[model samples]
Target chain A: MSETTEKTYKRSHEPVFWGLFGAGGMLTAFLTPVMILITGILIPLGIINSQNFSYEKIHGFATTWYGAVIVLVLVALPLWHTLHRIFHALHDIGINRGRDWQQVICYGFAFAASIFVFTLLLQMF
Target chain B: MTKRKPYKRELPTDWWLKHAFYTKYMIREGSSVLITLYSLILAWGVLRLSQGEAAFNGWLEALQSPFSIFIHLLALALALYHTITWFSLAPKAVDLWLKGKRLEDKVIVAGHYGAFAVVTVFCLLIITL
Candidate 1:
């Protein structure tokens, strides 16, 4: 078989997505396990009392500004990060057709979820 | 005239599992699933909070199940693995310059760990309060 011809292409506008991916990655690396420890292990295992995250306390926390910010960051960034990875994984797994549709769906879901969560948090305030 | 046949080797889809290097890379990439799960869980909690105290309490009680605990343990393991790999790579993505010289990789890596520790403590403080 003959070798395929080489061609030049313009750079992709993926830096924006990469920026979100990096931020989401950093946040997940630092924060996710800690959150699991508190909610999953400590509370369920009785290491820390269950009431620590009781409805009253948690609701109060949600109404606070800093709490809202934390929740927003914690929820939104990881969504972007995960969808971004899934998008690339699809290409790696060789379903490379319909690139435009794939990009729109994957990133679009992250965008919609972020907006939805932000709106909910604002409504709580 | 003579005709020649083309030789080709198809890559298996599970090729990543065949080598330790590829396996590690795939696992690191896949850790995003765990991160996404935790994010959704948190978002759900926030949603419950917005609904009112009863809904939030129900959500908290749901979290107390043995199944939930198991999932959390699994998530914690994946999250830790993600953290280790991500931190080791942090210096590559971040640049710090001082006195017209680039900082050492060791310094950057160490700084990430230090900041991680501080953040962990801050989280604990906030949670316990």
Candidate 2:
């Protein structure tokens, strides 16, 4: 091939974020409402016994391997999905300045929060 | 730098507010804000959980406040909206071919709802029972 015909393609980092976004979106869509109902409404309103959500029981659950993973996923994955949408929604709403900074802040918040939860879980374990 | 200034059409900030379709689209996208807040609450709970039982219980106690309850209610509504929008868009992502025929959109959408119901009930059961 002649040098004039040779072309280079740069890889985009979009698919990684998109994969996390898709997985998080699926989890959020299927589980978030019921989760909010149980933890936020039922338990708080005393419709469900507070003992069910007592510190001991919740602490025990968080200490376990599977429970830690569940807690991390429940707490963090939706963040990836939501932040992704918020990033795009910023553009849609016409906050068009600093696209790079927007992407960094959006995805960076999710990354930082995920790490925060992961570290907490690890310490508990 | 080459002086090639392309014309850029400006987008009005309230473009989505002008049409019902765009409004609903914006609402669907807007659900993310509340959901993100909900996740941060959960994350904060985890941080408290790591602190100690007393700290964790304090977090739970704080959640019982009127403001917390109201926020949760709003989050729940937005979350359910997100679920509906996500399921409606499911058919596009799940393109299944069986016996040389594409699956109907309603079938795929219904399947998601069915699974969503099962998962919801299952979580409630595990938490309560």
Candidate 3:
């Protein structure tokens, strides 16, 4: 009974994930519209020729060191952002069970995918 | 000692749909899925590029399909909504001070938009020029 009354504060290690989430959110915010404009609107409307993102052009771009880094950041960060939201949304919708495993799976997938992308980009160079 | 019972409120499964703000927020959060889809497509492009030129070209052509176009359009709408909401919320998260005075929210928001425009131009130069 005394143990139950004792004050114990457990800190959630959400800051780390939050940091990634913020960065990802910021990047996605600033960039997604531009991406949509170029790929979705321009290409489909033929406002910009397909040759702009042609295989040779994209391959050349990706092979460059800067391009690889940009691609890695773009692909990985929003992933962390998405998974973080989905993880919290699960709780919001009342799936409060198995939180520990949920966190592992949600964040673990982003970490693994990021690593996978980094390695693949490295191999291209 | 008084016997006290704390009030308990249960969260509805569709709590997000219950209010205007909650619905808006949920939509913003849910937009992340579209962002993820775009990221995966880009990542797939990278992977294909690593495979070979033929594979990459094939993928590019495949992107021109009607289904692909429809998906991209959907992604664009979701992404646009995400960007607008995110930008509007940016100033709240960022605190800027100048000469011991706090900056106005408009200034901070404008700064974000300005930076976004500059980056967009830079990217356009890289991709289209």
Candidate 4:
């Protein structure tokens, strides 16, 4: 094998994706444990979960709305980041060889997965 | 037939992707792990609500614990960071089809922050009420 001969092409992704990815990450880092505390802890303990629990209507609204909005952001944003990140990773390894087919497949998988997760969450609650 | 890269440069293949600084940046790049976890908790809250007040109370009690409180504060900080960055970055992704032209990034980002401020204040008032 002679010294490196072929030049590989690498296209760095756009900034918007990275920016959103970072934001989404920060969101989960802070939000998850708190949610876990409130629901996973509060509900299961049988203390605050009562027929006449304070602010029933408000509680109901908060639970439903928070869940719905978050489900959208959770599944979609991460997939976007993953698709962009993976392509770059592949480029680094120099395996893609600049084929449009590869891009389509990788991106397609991420999109399909996002749709599936979103659909599942919507259907469930 | 010949191919052309209008923007061409000779860069060591994957050189930019290899630096320690760049690696940390990439780790930070996919902060959506935080979002997925964030949403899952909300979904859990929804389920608790459906289950009834006792369930919700149980959840709240767990949250009130010292360990949980620490986690909540940490999470809040992370969430605030995400929201600020997301709002700031909102402009570039928008598709504003005005005479086949798009709006500027700064304008789009500004619009998001403005909307965020308005909504946040509105929510605060409602909580007070």
Query: What is the C-alpha lDDT profile of model 4 across B1-129, one tens digit per residue?
Result: 679658878766656477986554444443434434444454454455456678855655555576755555555555555556556655655688678778877777777666656655553344334
lDDT of 2 by residue, B66-100 (tens): 99999999999999999999999999998799999
- lDDT score, residue A81, model 1? 83
Please give, for residues B1-129, the per-residue lDDT of candidate 1 as tens digits: 669888899988888888998899888878777767777787787788889988977887888898888888888998899889988988887778999888888898898889889988888777777
TM-score of each: 0.88, 0.92, 0.90, 0.48
User: DockQ numbers for every candidate?
Assistant: 0.68, 0.85, 0.65, 0.13
lDDT-better candidate, 1 vs 2: 2
TM-score of chain A of each: 0.85, 0.91, 0.88, 0.49
Best by DockQ: 2
Candidate 3 lDDT, tens digit per residue, A13-85?
9999999999988888888778877876676567788778877777787779998888889888889988999
- Candidate 3 on B1-129: residue-level lDDT in tens? 878988999877998899999999988888877777888887787788889988887777777788888888888888878878888988788877999988888988888888989988987776677
Candidate 1's displacement at residue B87, Å, is 0.9
Encode model 4's per-residue lDDT on A1-125: one tens digit a residue: 67577878888665666675455443433333333333334433443343323437535444475755654564355555545555566665567576577678756765666665555445545
Off by over 4 Å in 1: A1-9, B1-6, B99-101
Best by lDDT: 2
Ten contiguous residues with the weakest lDDT in model 3 chain A: A36-45
Clashing pairs for model 2 are none
Superposed on the true chain A, the predicted chain A of model 1 yields a TM-score of: 0.85
Evaluated on chain B only, what is the TM-score of candidate 1? Answer: 0.89
Model 3 chain B scores worst on lDDT over the 10 consecutive residues at: B56-65
